[model samples]
Target: MFDMIIKNAKLRNAKDLVNIAIKNGLVKAIERNIEGKAIKEIDAMGNLVTPPFCDPHLHLDAALSVGDPRYNMSGTLLEGIQIWGERKPNLTKEIIKKNAIEAIKWEVANGTLKIRTHADVCDPRLLCVEALLEVKEEMKDLVDIQIVAFPQDGIYAYKNGDKLLEEALKMGADVVGGIPHNELTREDGVKDIEYVFELANKYNRLIDVHCDETGDDQSRFVEVMAKLTIDNDMEGLVTASHTTAMHNYNNDYAFKLIGILKRAQMNIITNPFDNSVLQNRTDGYPRRRGHTRVDEMLNRGINVCIGHDSIMDPWYPLGKGSMLQGANLLMHYAHLSGYDQIYELYDMITNYSAKTLGISNEYGIEVGKPADMIILNAKDEMDAIRLMSECLYVLRKGKVVSQTKPSISEVIFNGKRENIDFIVER
Candidate 1:
C-alpha cells in the first residue's frame, strides 16, 4: 500500500481528474483510479494541484522590521536604506532570528517551500548572518533556505564591505550577492560587478545581484552582470534581481540588451509588490511603473521569475508572504491578463522560480519526484490568480505539512438561500 493518495485532482493543462499515489516520499503512480487502498487518502474534489511556490529573492535579515526605528517618511528607496541603517546597529541576534522564523513560517503556511534570502553583510559584526545560518540549519527539514551574503551597501563605497561579505561567505552563506548600482560611481559599479563575479568563481557559488533597481536610464549594471556571467562561463548560474531600469531604457538599448541577457542565460526576478510603490517615487504625474520589461523578456525566452522581495521590511512596508498575491499585482502592472499569459504569470511563481534556485530538475508532480505539492482551492491557474486562492493542503515529501479548509460562500438571493462558489454558468 502507498503512504498517501490524493483523489480527483485537477492538474494544470490536463483535462481529466486523476489520482496520485505517494510512497517513500515520492510520487509512486498517477492514474484515473488506483486498484488498492492507501494508509491515508484525500478527496481534492477537482481542486488544482501544483508544485509549491518558490521565492527567489527576499531580505530576511530586515523582514518584519518595518518601523523599528521610524516609519519611512519619504517612502523612497534611499529613505528606506537610511532607515535600515539606523535600525541595524540596535539589532540583537535573538530579535533577528525571531523575526526571520516568523517570516519563514508565513511563507511555508502559504506553500512557499524554497526561498533565497539576502542577509546583509555590510555590518562589521555579521550578526544577521550568524543568526540566520543557525535558523537555516534548524529549519532545514521544513524548508530549503539559501542565504546570500548580501552587500546591501555598495561593496566599495562602504568601509571594508568586501571583507565583511567574504567573511559572511566563509561563515556559511550559500550565495554571493551585490548591489552594483548603489556604488558611488560608474567605475565603482563596474568594479563591484567584477568583484562579485570573482568571489562567485573563487568559491563556486551562485551569483545574484540587485542590478539596476532605479528609474535612471543610465543605471545599467544588469548589462555588466550579463557580460560577466558569459565571460566567467557561469551563464546559467547568475541571477539579476530588480532590473527596474529596463523600463526606462530606450527601445534601441533594450533591444540590444535583451539579446545579451538571452546569450548569458541570466535569471531575472521582478518584485512587483515592492517595486510597484518603491520605484518611480521621485517622478511626476504620468510616471511609469518601476519594473523591468517582463512581457518583453518573457517573449524573448529568458528565464523570468517573480519575487516577494520584502515582508514588512524597510523597503516595502507590507507583504503576506504569498507568491500568488505578488503574481496578482504583477498581472496588473505587467498587463498579463490574456488567456495564455495568465499561465505564464503562474509559472513565474513556480517553475520559473525553481529554475532560478536551480531546483527545477527535481521539482514538480512527476513519478519518481519528491511529493512536494500544494492543493489549491481553485480549478486552474486563472481562477487561482484571480481569487488568490488558499492552499488547501501543503505536502512535503508525501507528508502533510499544513492544511486549510476550503472556503465556502453562501448567498441569499430573491428570498432564497443558496451556495454560490463563484461558478460560471457557461
Candidate 2:
C-alpha cells in the first residue's frame, strides 16, 4: 500500500531495527516495525541509513579541467588561478555542460544528492552560467543543484564584472557568490562583500561568498560578511566558504569574529582537502595548517559543514568527488579524533551541510520528510568514516537511484583459507 519499504535499518537515534515507509515521494512512517506492502522493498541488512550528503561549496565550472593548458607546477593558489584563467577562455557551453554533468554523475553516485556549485560569471561570454543553468534544469529530477553566480575575478577588479554578475542572476542563477580576498585591496574586498549582499537582497536569492580563502591574516572579509548578514537580518541565509585565513589570525581577533559569526547565525563551510594543500605554499620551516577553526566553530554551536571544493580542478589536482573522503581529511587536519567529534564529522557531511544549503526541512530520515537518504555498509558513524564505507543504496524522492554491492575477498595464506571484508575483526 506504499511506494517502497526499507527493513532492518540502523538509524542513528535508534537502538532496535527501524523500518521506513515511503508514500508518494515522502517518508510516511518510521518505527521499530513497519507493516504493509509496497511496490519495492529493500533489506538494509543492519547498515547505517542516513540522509544523503550535501556539499555546500563546489566549483563545477572548472571541475575535472585540471592541466587543460598547463599544470600548476608552483602548487599555489595564485598559480592555480592563473591556470584556470588560461583555461576558461577556451571553454564552450557544450564543453562546460558535458564536464559538469559528468562531475554530477560522479557525485550523485557517491550519495551527494544536494549541491551548491559556483559558476564563474566574470567572463564576457557568460558561458559557465549558461551551461550550469541548463544543467540545473537537466538534472533537476535526480538531484538538487543550486547554481551560484560566482565572480572568480574580483567584482570591482574588472570594469564590467558587476554587470556580468547581474546578467547571470537575470539568467536564473539561484545564489550570489563572491571572492573578496582576491580583490585589488582590502577596502575593495570589503566593498565586494557589500556588492554581493546587495545583489542577494535584490534578487531574494541565497548568498554564498568565498570569503578570505587566502592564508594572509589580513584577508578578513568574513567579519564584513557577518556584519552584513546580521544588519540585514539574513542570518541562516548566508554562507561563508573557505575562510582559511582564520587559521592565521591572533586569538583576540579570532574570538571577536567568532562572537559576530554566532550572532549572525551564518553558515561556515570549510574545504579541508583543497585548503590544506592550496594554502600555506609561501611559508617555509613552520608552515601553517591553512584550515579554518572548524572544531572551535562546532563547539560554539555555529552551523559548520565540509565540502569537496575541487574535483581534479585547477585548485586541487586530486579529488574523487567523495564527501566521506572530504570528512576523513577534515578529521585529520582539524584533529577531530575524539569519539564524539568523529560523529560530529559525519554530521558535517550530512545534516549540517544540508542546513548550510538551506535544505534541512526536506532532508534527513524522519517521518513527513522527503525520503532522500543513503544506506552505507558500516554499522555506525565512526565505522563509516574509518572504512570510507560503500553506499549500498541511494534513494531520492522515495525511489532508488544507485546501489553498490560490497566486495569480499578470499585469502589463502600458509595453507589457511579465510574470508576478508572491509571491516577487519580479530
Best by lDDT: 1
Model 1 per-residue lDDT tens digits across residues 1-426: 999999999988899999999999999999999878899999999999999999999888899998889988787999999999999899999999999999998998899999999999989999999999999998887889999999988899899999998998899999999998999999999999999999988888999999999999999999999888888899789999999999999999999999999999999999998899989888898899889999999999999999999999888899989999999999999899888999899999999999999998889999999999999988898888988889999999999998987677888889998887885633
Clashing pairs in 2: none
Per-model TM-score versus the true fold = 0.98, 0.98
What are the C-alpha RMSDs, in order, of all predicted structures? 1.1, 1.3
lDDT of each: 0.92, 0.90
Q: Candidate 1: which pairs clash?
A: none
